[model samples]
Target chain A: MTQTAPRPTLEAVAERAGVSRATVSRVVNGAHGVREALAERVRRAVEELGYVPNQAARSLVTRRHQAVAVVAAEPETRVFADPYFAQQLRGISKELTAHDNQLVLLLTEGREDHARVGRYLAGGHVDGALVFSLHLDDPLPALVRGAGLPTVFGGRPGWDEGLDDVVYVDSDNRGGARSAVRHLAGLGRTRVAHITGPLDQTSAADRLAGFRDVRPDTDPGLVARGDFTSGGGERAMRELLDRCPGLDAVFAANDLTAAGALRVLRERGLRVPDDVAVVGFDDMLPVAEESDPPLTTVRQDIEGMGRLMARLLLRGLDGEAPEAADGAPVPAASGVILPTTLVRRATA
Target chain B: MTQTAPRPTLEAVAERAGVSRATVSRVVNGAHGVREALAERVRRAVEELGYVPNQAARSLVTRRHQAVAVVAAEPETRVFADPYFAQQLRGISKELTAHDNQLVLLLTEGREDHARVGRYLAGGHVDGALVFSLHLDDPLPALVRGAGLPTVFGGRPGWDEGLDDVVYVDSDNRGGARSAVRHLAGLGRTRVAHITGPLDQTSAADRLAGFRDVRPDTDPGLVARGDFTSGGGERAMRELLDRCPGLDAVFAANDLTAAGALRVLRERGLRVPDDVAVVGFDDMLPVAEESDPPLTTVRQDIEGMGRLMARLLLRGLDGEAPEAADGAPVPAASGVILPTTLVRRATA
Candidate 1:
């Protein structure tokens, strides 16, 4: 093997600066109670020696990697194609950069890749993890918990055991769906149909439940299932139209689905808000804005939720006490659910 | 600090398996010349102890971290919003997962973050890097080269010095453009206009060269500049119409631009293929297929390029000799340019 260039060590810096190892360590860690003169000497020595503090070496001594893992649990293409993950990732990037931490992205494809992720997390490569797009019955949540590392879920996780103990941030899915349906109802569209996302995930299920809360006796034919994709939405809308030709309104699970539904409505010679008023969830700016007729949708603070997830994990890493209620410290498992708002647009 | 659970060491595994320390080490590293019975014993002991090989420890011993940094050099929302990155990431993720390597995602927001990235790469946290979306004035390429870490550029990089030494993977932009113009000429469309992407990028520049290659003395008014976005495309298309209202055909630099131009044409009451024929680059499925009239486009193997980049970096890590021609070893800086094909669709 070729000989590699040697890096300067803390001991070398201490010797050059005429200080003890402890003093150099304190200066590097920015701990209080260090003499200003000694700290300056160490800093100057570090600059002269071009001594970059090796994260691996620091991790070995302090048991902190100064890095976080972001596991995007998207096994299929639909979730990855959604602008939701990109917006959330942008927010996470800003927060992580501010903290001087690294972001390790692990995109899990399916069950086969889960073991690899489990080993990586358990192997002490990162201090904490932020996971997203978890599906019901996924073994990843359990494996992540088993790793015994600080973790924050991006969405409302769907595991049976220790459900209340999982730290997560989520939008008010049920409430958003309720508001969307109510908007359609207020628009006086009585025969309202619904196009839900895949029923396997919690967000889709919650949205379906919210739709039922508004119209309990709706025709079974009026409800169709989509996969949170425009293609799937088009298919579902076509089925709904065939089953209930007189339906006057539709609530889609997301903006992409709404875009698809709009295409079908236009093809079928139906004018938006006149033939079928439409409302979508998660106002993904590009899709919602670009869709023909400009979809009326529920706008969740997706980026804000992403920022919150990172902040919560960092707080746990700092060992700060969790917020308390009634003089009792709340469990770290507690999460924050951000509110969602309905944005009125040309569609409704 | 709270006590962390002690991890089982090689010595402990050796003792449990009734093997020597060297034997256990060889088994863990997958070295050859180990007896089958002894290897099985060591494997069982490791399983019983739940030993996950410590990446940090292994990295220290082998000088290989098994982690590669993927720097998304886009601070703007456009790159993230584009499905291009998602496709590339999927390919990179699949390849890295297969190799049991981790991906460290470094998203640079602006100039300040560039310094942070330079420091991180120079800090020895990862083995190699894969950088994307390099702009004309980006100093990242030079910094990465100075850090002495192996790197692969996603697109044709925009560096001026040692241009032959910059390893990258790019599509045949000039060739693709030639084919697009040829198709228009074959249709006897004389007043062909061009919507060009930002000139700083080599892809956009090369596409313009190809357009000029076909129409050497085309009217100056036929060329308009766009920024590889739908909005930019709309503005550029309007400008092209203002300059040459009777233009019969257009070749957009990208699909998003084409989509934008199509919308403008619709608003202006021009018929597609009848009044104006359009062709776009980057056959992005959703955009190309979903446009009002399915777009004719130049299809580049984006995912394949991403996979090849990861493969090249991994090969460098493995110390494999580069391919040779005429009995001379090829230079490591050599790159591959994938081909592009024109797919005929509704508009053209």
Candidate 2:
């Protein structure tokens, strides 16, 4: 979700008019009880202007659109191929329905479409925005903030940079990876090679950091990088096998990579767990079931995360629009962090 | 996705102005070059309130909002359980991203929240809408149509009711199921059982009808039922097997159910493809691979269906709002059925 700046309201008009909000509301509502001269004056001015009474907006302000737009800053093919996108979406869809909010999925797959998305978010298109796979150079954050709409994101760059409190809901990659490595060490595996996801993502970087944090004595070259994909995993595994044939265990950053490593190992005539125990992260169900023997991996409750993201944004929407309250200071934007865990299965 | 109504635009206003469209545009946009006296008169009349036009919106009119909301008129739990959503989301996201359009997702699960959904759609928060699921009795189709936004449904309901031209994109369930049954009969399987999904959904009903259409000679009692879930399939299979102990083959509506039946047969100490050859539908990759021997099934690209829904809605946004064009006729809500095929594997 992007950080929404603030929605315009009658209260803002009241502040600008140097009058009580109730008085402005009364004028906007067209109540007849006001002083005749003032009522006539307000009516004439309001006629010279278009203003929808609160009746048109009150229910809309609180009612569930039951839909939230999923604005993606990634390409179409990449978005579909991403297993993470599917998992997160499944989780988000589950959570929203539970909350009685439906998901409106959208993507800005090309750079040309970026400006259009900024305008869309600002133009009252969605109740709130769930932004995904944003690049560092993306302008959506600034644009959404300028528009003052409620927003959330899968991952964000920083909090104190351009905006005050941008909400970012992300995986506990560091902790999950640390646990995976600890589990391997506990099982007495001395030579464990790691399959790392792409270095560009914080998720991939954090996982690699956590693995080394737990194994300070490990050889740096043992980390064979992959692109968090099955094909990447296969390529990385073959490289690792050639570089460190004595490696007794492997922990790929995600299930797809782990699955790829398993296929390669099977072709290389190695027995899982007996010859080279393997573990994967993001315990995608197939990763557990499809390995010659099922995989031992870290499991993240993706649906729960989606639900959390929705609730957090809903909580954000629960506040009143930033109205001038007798010239008081600005209110604080709340921030939250969720917990993660590891699930042990067959491969390890 | 449901087809939606047309939007209000500056051109519509200009056409309503009874003046040259450029004159109306100049008056609405507050061009300083206009004659002062004429500007005052035009401003007075325009402000007498056709609609509110902020500086940003003055260029467009009533305003585009530049966003679309998706309301899946189903429980969130159901949305998460199926893979169709992830696929559809991919498609919708791809197209919307191409246009830089914001997509909002919403689900209506609880009773209190369900009531709130309609107001949000009508409140002019979004320029258009997309609906993922529908019951014939659902008030959303009417509410969305009444709000005057374009809509598309992921699948069509059994009856269109008042929404005569509600645009919907769906897969050819009957055709797919017919092909599945024909494949089973062609294999020389004499006694076959069919597992069907929930009857409320047209897909489930049509698939069951397709199965019957192909094999009228099979016992009517062989039609067991599941809710597209593995657990449901297991229970349905228990009933079918007990009722028809002599059955030689089974066709489960989806892979999840087929997997469930496979488990039950294994538990009952029956051999697959020998005592009972089994087939399934929706060849989603994971479940198919994990079966004792991969299962043969009908394949539907749920993701592709989702993408098409996005495409249809995007097409509608191409030119003058459908209402103004005679050829398009707001594209009287139509239905689209995608193709499906049978994928052969070891189980069948």
Candidate 3:
């Protein structure tokens, strides 16, 4: 990095504009104080000759690439393809723009790409990092911190105990699952089977755990593993139907998986709600609205989770305490465990 | 730019490994380098930090961040919400990783944040930029070009003649739209009203032009403008029904818009193929599999377009000529216009 003359000092501008250094500083540095006309003149004068003051000019300032990095430990296609990603990104993008921060999305597609991602994230490539769709054993959390960068996770992260300070926003998965199971039981479906998500994810594990906690007498034989994917759910459904044809109830971990199960059920010529009462989690809007017999699901407040994630990262980036932004209407909640309502649709 | 010391040159590494200088250079650059044994020793010696006579240290090579930025000018929600973004992203992410480059995604949500986007693209924040979904007359193309950034447009861009050097990858909208029209026409439907997207976009203009090209005598008055959104499509459909009540067919610019048209058509108590022979563009999986009557429409080569966009940018980043990579065994075309097929569904 070559050294050049300090970018036209605000003090030099103060003298040139014949105004107080405070006024020149306010206008040049984009602080909120000086009047509009005076600020305009200072800005015009500053722009006459090239000047971009980085750090050394002020202590009160924060580093503003005006960009944040959103890294996915998964493929970019899956992250971008999922409506959930879109919904979450919408929230983060909207909030970041409000704070004048741009978002940089990065996908660590594989091992070599992962190292590259680590270096980029470490090399001041972004103001901060937003990590999503991480598995329980992903080392990225530690790698990001080891690089001395502030990082936040989009879901209830399954990091090791050492990462107590790592910030994350998650839905109330256990409660959501517990309630869904109770809804099925209330419907008097005797043989309830659980289609769970990938075991490496906390949401998947927690939801299953919550279901068990609600129905302690349930047979462990009813459990099945899904990768939170529609295909996985479809295959899992086929397996469950083959093994336990007499099953009367099924609770899918996610709406996509649930929809797949519904398809299988329809193909199998099973009458939904009557033959097999089913309830899904994460009542995605498209899924809820479009299904053959509209799906009944437990809703998660994804937008709220996204906003809280942004706020937490903003606070961390600002070196502020983890407290929610002062009376300035803190987004919904700090680490929101938003309630999941059981929408009683035709499925259950 | 001042010349630094002549560190170990490629010649020394060749001599050390008993190989040609070209082989040493290839190994050092991580190209399809020399065989593993010689490559290993070269790497080992480089890691030892003792050889400086003929080979530059890896630290110099490490300076290349190997990261490119994908700048989606629309809001985060729009990019993520659209399945197209996810599909294209999957393709780009896969290709970039294969070439050992990291893909960074940037969201330029508003006009003001766009300036910051320019800086991020220019400041070596990334080596190249991939832009998708820009409005017709946005300044980003010119701004990035002026910043001396290698950029690619995910779609055939609208305006910005000066930025023609910015390579673009888009589906064959014209052919796709024409095929869709022919499908409707083959179905014995006349009086098709085109619900076009915003006039500024090439997609919108091209689709409308294609429809007219197929049937020029069809009433131009039946056309209505939509913002490539469901709500806008619904409104456009209503307007078409009110203005051209005799219309028998409707072609929407995208599936989201088509879904909207379906909603409005359903609300108006009109039968799908009997009353309005509706067709859509971009045979997105969700729309094709889920739409009411399983919408009969055009399908763009989304994944292929994404890979080509990334490959074009990668070539640019390497200071190589920009060329399309259409998932061909050996890319046969530069101006690749991917073909589209009309799937006969219940809609048309």
Most accurate candidate by DockQ: 3
lDDT of 1 by residue, B66-134 (tens): 778888777735556658887887777666666766766666556666766766675666777888855
* Per-residue lDDT of model 3, residues A1-348, tens digit only: 888775676566666666655455445544432456676777876786555554543422345565677877776546655678777877777667667677777776654566677778767667677888558777676566544455678887786553334457888899999999999999888899999999889899999998998888877768888888788889989989988999999999998889889899999999998999888999898887587689999998787666667766776565453344222445433344656788878899
DockQ of each: 0.20, 0.30, 0.48
Better of 2 and 3 by TM-score: 3
Superposed by TM-score, candidate 1 places the C-alpha of residue B284 at a distance from the truth, in angstroms, of 3.3
Fill in the DockQ of model 1: 0.20
lDDT of 2 by residue, B182-293 (tens): 8878888888899888887778888898988988777778988798888999999899889998888898888988999999888888888888888888888788877877
For each of the candidates, give the backbone clash count: 0, 55, 9
| A1-348 per-residue lDDT for model 2 (tens digits) | 999655546656544554434344445543222344544554554444444455544443344455576766776556656666666776666555555554656555566676766665555445677777545556655655544445777764433452323566766778888989999889999998999988766678788988998887888668899988889999999999999999999989999899999999999999888889888988777656776678888887775556556655654554432322223232333333445677766788
lDDT of each: 0.79, 0.68, 0.73
Indicate whether candidate 1 or candidate 2 has the larger lDDT: 1
Model 1 CA deviation exceeding 4 Å by range = A1-66, A163-165, A173-200, A204-299, A320-333, A340-348, B1-63, B98-100, B123-125, B181-193, B214-222, B237-251, B258-279, B286-296, B321-333, B344-348
Look at candidate 1 and tell me the lDDT of residue B67: 77
Best by lDDT: 1
Q: What residue runs in model 2 are displaced by over 4 Å at the alpha carbon?
A: A1-72, A75-105, A108-112, A126-130, A134-152, A156-194, A211-219, A244-348, B1-67, B85-103, B108-112, B134-148, B163-165, B169-194, B208-219, B229-348
True contacts kept of each: 0.27, 0.60, 0.86
Query: What lDDT score is found at residue A122 in candidate 1?
Result: 63
